[model samples]
Target: MLSPRFQGLKIIVSDSAMRELFKLGKDMHDVLEVLESGYDAPRKRKAGTIERWLDKGKKTVNAIIALDYNETMQEECWVLVHFGKFARNKK
Candidate 1:
């Protein structure tokens, strides 16, 4: 069962994203949690990308998504392009 926050939101996982998710041992629940509660930020105009951050219990995960707004259907769909742990620069 999906959480209420994910209701009416269409999510598509890309091949690359699926591979990354498997590599990171993340499932759809993790992705949905990020989309529901993570910090959302706008990205470049290409494909209407958006960046989101999810705070797991031990670490944070970052997700890149491409969004499409369907005016005819009056729906918003998003594709997960990439997702992985949030890497911090160690300077």
Candidate 2:
């Protein structure tokens, strides 16, 4: 389950991101937590993103989300398209 903060926005995880999630030992909750509280990745310009940094042990994971609408469902959703850039933790 997700928090009410998400409200009407649907949450989706990409197929490749699923593998990365396992590699980082993270789940949807962890991903949501990171999205809820974020650090702006000003340098990254992937798919016109609202960027955020997520940490997992020695590596820092990137959570790239894209906003999209479901015309058929008549609702908006946030897609976790990419989540596999494991850089060294900055802080």
Candidate number with greatest TM-score: 2
lDDT of each: 0.74, 0.70
Tell me the tens digit of each residue's lDDT in model 1 across 1-91.
6422244667777899999999989888888778778986544445467778876666678877777665655878777888889654445
Candidate 2 lDDT, tens digit per residue, 11-90?
A: 77778888889887878777777777657665857564566886657866667778887676687777777776565835
Superposed model 2: Cα runs more than 4 Å off: 1-8, 44-48, 55-58, 89-91
For model 2, what is the error of residue 43's alpha carbon versus the real structure, in angstroms, after optimal superposition? 1.4
Candidate 1 Cα outliers beyond 4 Å, as residue runs: 1-7, 41-47, 69-76, 89-91
lDDT of model number 2 = 0.70
If scored against the real structure, what TM-score would every candidate get? 0.67, 0.70
